[model samples]
Target: MKPIRALSNADEVVRLLGSEGDMSPAEIAERLDIPRPSVYRLLDGLESIGLTESVPGSRARLNLRWLHLADQARESMVEWAGARELLSELVERTSQTAYLTVLRGHEAVCLEWEQGRAVGVLLLKPGRSLPLYAGAAGRTCLAFGVNVEEYLDTVTERRAYTADTLTSDAALRADVEATRRRGYVFSDEDVTDGIAAIGVPIRGSRGQLLGALSVSGIKVEYLAKRDAYLEALLDVAGRLASLNEAAIQ
Candidate 1:
């Protein structure tokens, strides 16, 4: 919420709109924990830049033009993050689909993904938005980068997607701490039953979290290849982070 972080907040606002569809200024301010006036000003800047649009009394949504930029951003980030080749290697090694996702506001946005020949799986499609609380991707974002308490408090929809989903505050906080300590995260049957995923946060040399690399498969398959998946994610973390800042600049 500081003035210096305005651009970062603006970037997050775009991701927020993507996750929630569309929102009023009041809704945005509430979700983002920023003042209404600041939200309005932010919205104004976005509109000026043609990233979003609002009718007088309606909720503001990302302009269609934003989609074009989003597509470009994806291509741009993949190249700089060195994620393309690494994701390919991941799928080849584990025969499970791999994903590279960025922590976007209260959700993790899929930036790039590759399919595996193992089980014909295809869940984490590009552009899909997932919760930043219940999956391996969420664990990395929560543990490594974001304001955990603020994220926990603001996110209202804690749907128990499956029997294994962790919805309690205490359980989730404990998992977050554990992820930090272990330097990785694993979610089994949390987002989807019969599927499991392992994730490692990608950090820059300066220790800033860039995003996460996760691989998912049928639970048995993932468990068998867990060690390999962790190693693959670790191998590219530095490359992704080192080039991410340059990509954005």
Candidate 2:
């Protein structure tokens, strides 16, 4: 039997297994049209690296060790000290939840969050991952006009979490257009029903998009005072972006 590496099918097998969850060698072989023995050999190598683990009475499953590397890479973005302080101030001033997030592997991960005074509002914690197709943070990142078409393609399969979620391609395009025109993104019941959010892009010194800073709250109060909240949200976003740019210098 030929070695898995010599057959040039090792990586594909690993990817298939990682994506499809636990599967026996025969199942992986059937899916990839490779010999079962080759799949087992590839799994052996993957297991040695701690990227794959054997499930009792089942095939190997993907391990989360790669996530540690991914987290390190994500944190390599500009230091969060200044940005987090500013975000905390924004939340204190507005008395609304504020979040700092960056695009991470097709999702927006909250790097920081400041709690609002609103009772019963859903609290977002640091390290929480949100879908790229929903919420103000995601839209703000998407509206930054950096390879947007490619990013949209990558997020096309995201499931809508609410009735107001922009699931259609055309609608998402339109939303992005509106967000670009407004210089920010706003959402009402898009991610969670009865929630509202507004966000703007944060750019680095060279004008590279660093992330998004957003203010979010419950729907009722937001609707009653939408314009005022919009102003505050935009103000904080602009301020944060400027601070980041200056710090990156």
Candidate 3:
């Protein structure tokens, strides 16, 4: 692998170790198909930052300290400039939880979300991240963020999170095209069952893709006020698009 790619492999290793806990260096190397020495180096770096811990028999466990750090980072980003107030306005106006997300290496990572005064699962809450090929927010990012077909080619599994998920590459491509044409995305029970989401791409003042602005709620609730909700989401996205880079990060 190229040195740059190898450097990034550490982050993928971190995510894997975080999700699948208590893995030995050998096991992690096998899972990632990298060298054992590289795994040890990545583990050493993670350990220095307190994101992982050595277990019995030289295994590694994801430390809870990472979650605390994540929480702090989320808090700081939310409180950054206009983010918190905008998300709050979005939630209050739509009565559905609103989320702001950014694309991090083909994955859409949630930066912040605001709970609305409605009943919903909130499965894609803040700090959670997912593949850009799935969900409304992720699809919006896929459509406007990069070349959809090329990006999906790099993803390994296109697993269906629900019956409505677009699993086939052709279907995903079509969906991305439609999202581009519509300038937003509308999804029902695609990522999480019983939840519906509508999203639009948020671009910076210079037209750089900042992230996605999405609002999710129970499907029944969405069906009842789809038009009004779509309008509100579009308005929120427009406002988000006008934000400065300093205020957006």
Error of 1 at 121 (Å): 3.7
Candidates' lDDT values, in order? 0.82, 0.76, 0.82
Report the C-alpha lDDT of model 3 over 1-249, residue by residue, as the tens digit: 677876688787887876677899999999999899989988898889888899899899888898888877866753234776889998888888888888888889888888878876566777778778788788888888887767767785877888898878888889988988888888888998888988888887667688898888888988888888888878877776666454645
Pairs with backbone N, CA or C atoms under 3 Å apart (clashes), candidate 1: none
TM-score of each: 0.70, 0.68, 0.81
Cα RMSD to the true fold for all candidates: 6.2, 5.2, 3.4
**Lowest summed lDDT window (length 10), candidate 2:** 119-128
Error of 1 at 6 (Å): 21
Give the Å shift of residue 94 in candidate 3: 2.1
Residue-level lDDT tens digits of model 2 in 200-248: 7777656677888888888887778767777776677677767766655
Ranking of models by TM-score: 3, 1, 2
Q: Please report the candidate that would top TM-score against the real structure.
A: 3
Cα displacement (angstroms), candidate 2, residue 172, comes to 0.8
